[model samples]
Target: MFCSLVFCSLCFWHLLVFGNSDTVKTVSVSVTDGDTITLQNNDSQLQDNYLLSWTFERPESRIAEINKGARNFLIHDGVPDGRFRDRLKLDNQTGSLTIMNTRTTDSGLYEMTIKSKKDDTYRFTVAVYAYLIAPVISSDSSRCFSPLSPCSLVCSSVNLGHATLSWYKGISVLSSISVSDLSNTLSLPLEVEYQDKNTYSCVLNNPISNKTTHLNTTQFCHTCAVDSSEGHANCCDSVEAVLRLVVTALMGVAAATAMFF
Candidate 1:
């Protein structure tokens, strides 16, 4: 009877070990972005029915229980700033998560835990990240300048956070500025003496985002005449008329002197 009891105990222990092993046959996952991830079911051909489960943990942290089902999944919703957020997905059919907008703060070893119908469990790790959006240049209006006046060139960001600013002329940097918020302006100094009809550009840059804005300067001269039709053939016609009047006055004086002679 003693030997029989011992044999029964050994068999029970084996059954427990074997049951646990069969539950976690395989585990796989997919990374979305800084905050989102997808877990996939790599093992389709399980010999027995098992409940798939998941768990997440940071380094040296306690395991957090996740959702459970035939295909189980979970997401880390409470992510901090500069970290990944709202970017994890799990496909029930395929058992995968589609991550979105990965960032540097999202970098960490993520773990996935699973359980089977026999109450067996398994775990795996995933890394997360936060991808930064580069800055872009913007202006209050596209047609910023009017005749004989200087307009301010403003630069802003589409997707930038806590970044420095810079101004450039083509390849060369003109100045460097900082922005506490998302928007800031670098106004170019305009002088009446600085009258060259040249195309100018101001560049805005953060480490992640970079962009440029163009500025056109308008000129007004005192000696310049205004044509009624403005920028048409009448402009040339008006200049020709003024030139003819000057020539006629000079020639009429010369004819009177020749008649006296």
Candidate 2:
């Protein structure tokens, strides 16, 4: 009875320590702020084996490799600087991979296959994003091409590394632009209908971060004008400019007639 008990205990212990090698495992990681990330295949018990081979598969790329015979670990050569380059680190002691300075192009599926007592595959999908800054809305305060057309307003962000800037009227987007590098700081233009009584806003965003600024039409311009493809109607000019002159002239004539009476 004692011998049977010992055998069962040893079998369960093996299962717990080694786990099911045939079963493939998956891990998901979200990296932000241009940080580093590490991926591990095995615990300390089987760390020295180096039986796992890491690969990037969405676009079919090579990542890092481990030799079972010499227990050597190295990141593959010829990978583009946009992919990994000198930023990859492999630990032979624990069979883990660390990538330094993660970028948007580094986002993809990474797979690891282990050939120990059983064949196991591990997959990691990495998503990297940068935080976006608040967008600014600027205009000349002069309606472009008169009041019938959309007033030209510029929405932009300054020195953003990787992000998208957008102009919005409520939930609808008028325009959006995505830039990885801030060669020019990025800007997008939109035409706003000042007489429409609708609120507008500027938005900057990424997969992980978002910032917004509401646009006040009063700050840019103060006239009510609706420009339609059918026709341009200057509401402010008709109500305030033309009628006010006629009404003032009529009031002067009435006072002259009253004094004569």
Candidate 3:
């Protein structure tokens, strides 16, 4: 009887351990604001008597659920906050959850549980980023006057979410700047020769998306038109000519005074 009781206890322990064993998986999802994002459970066909549940941020707050046995579908969008009101969806056939018009506030951990003959759990870490605008390339007006000096260019954009502004020469990165705050203006400066021939571009990017603007050296960098007679294109040429004339005049006056003396 003692041996039998020990055997029964061991069997009970094994049942407790193996009976509740379920597959759990964690996935990362990233989406842009105002876009729809779906978290899949890989269950194409759910059992006739199945229970699927989803919770957001914390496990206590249930966001959505589907029960095939009860023939019911529920969305607890009003639990955590009204931020998810009317934006949550669930697929009864595949047991997938989709959020429409996702916002940055909706970014957090989402947990899904499916209970049937086989139990499975899925955890998703969702991140929603604001749409990124293309960086604008403009030449600094103060630095554009001198044709002999390096041309100063600025790449600017309105910061959206966590974004980085980068200047690239061909495929290699020349320099980069980033800001974590949103709606602020971000600018990165790059200096290049007026006659630069290498390809360069400015890019604004986040983890999931990027926008690029190519640098047009001729469009942004302006050199003074060459004088047809002088065959030179420089803003300082006229000043240099004036200085030469003044020196020559000074020399002539000195020579005349010496002759008179």
Candidate 4:
């Protein structure tokens, strides 16, 4: 009875450790480019040596070629039409592959298989990633203020690199929390309202890269007219220009006006 109990405990202990070692064996996978991928074995049981192989599912093919005594190995198949070819390379030592210049069509499920001399086989799956290009702020320009003319600036995100757009002035943000789109119109209120021209800045920021750029200009007048020898132009032109200036300056105020009214 005693011998049987001791033998049973020993068997249980060996099974526990061996079962965990088998379960822990796996490989970490990543897609480097449209044509390249990397796979690394995570097993740390200190096994003697292992063979790594890959199989493509959708096309149903194997990359390994048969040789007399040597096991299957990864080789560059060259760039394939609508398929990753020249981009595939395998690092036997580290079990990694570099895919150069990835394309959208390269996305697919991949499988990595590892085999040991003892016939132990391990498999793992890797999912590829390619994020959609986000919005970006390309450039901004600003104009200084003149006695009769108000200051103005334009922020445009012609192409996208980052996401979520905003404008700022110094430490204080000039845009509202709701300001989150490209080519947003702005109106500003200067703390010091007077004839003396003050320097102001317009800042553009994107959420993804958290990048910001400032456009500086002299303070624009709130109720000023463009300098014209003929008393700020005749009634028609004067009204038109004044109306345009007011409209630009009032943009920022509109956000606060709703609360006040």
What digit string (tens of lDDT, one per residue) describes model 2 on residues 1-261?
Answer: 010111122212122224644666666666664677777654543534446677876435667777766856668834644457787887666566787877666777887777777776767777776645688888874433334446667888886756888888899988888888745487898776747678789989876678999988777756655678648554544335556579989999999999989
Displacement of the residue 24 alpha carbon in candidate 4, Å: 5.6
* lDDT-best of 2 and 4: 2
Question: Which residue segments of model 4 deviate by more than 4 Å?
Answer: 1-18, 24-39, 42-51, 55-71, 75-83, 102-111, 117-154, 158-162, 169-210, 218-261
> For model 3, how does the per-residue alpha-carbon lDDT over 1-261 read when each residue is reduced to its tens digit?
011111122222121123457777676667788888777755557779988899988889898899999889988888697889998777778777778888888889998888888887777777888788899999755333344567778999985788999999999999998887776788899998867799999999999899999998888787655577887544543544566589999999999999989
What TM-score do all the candidates reach, one by one? 0.35, 0.58, 0.74, 0.42
- Give Cα-based local distance difference scores for all models: 0.41, 0.68, 0.78, 0.40
Q: Write the per-residue lDDT of candidate 1 for residues 127-201, one digit (tens) a residue.
A: 331223433444333232333443444444443334455555555656666554434433333232235455455
- Estimate the TM-score for candidate 4: 0.42
Better of 1 and 2 by lDDT: 2
Screening candidate 3 with a backbone cut-off below 3 angstroms (N, C-alpha, C), the clashing residue pairs are none
Best by TM-score: 3
**Candidate 3 deviation (Cα RMSD):** 11.2
lDDT order of candidates, top first: 3, 2, 1, 4
| Candidate 1 global lDDT | 0.41
Residue pairs in clash, model 2: none
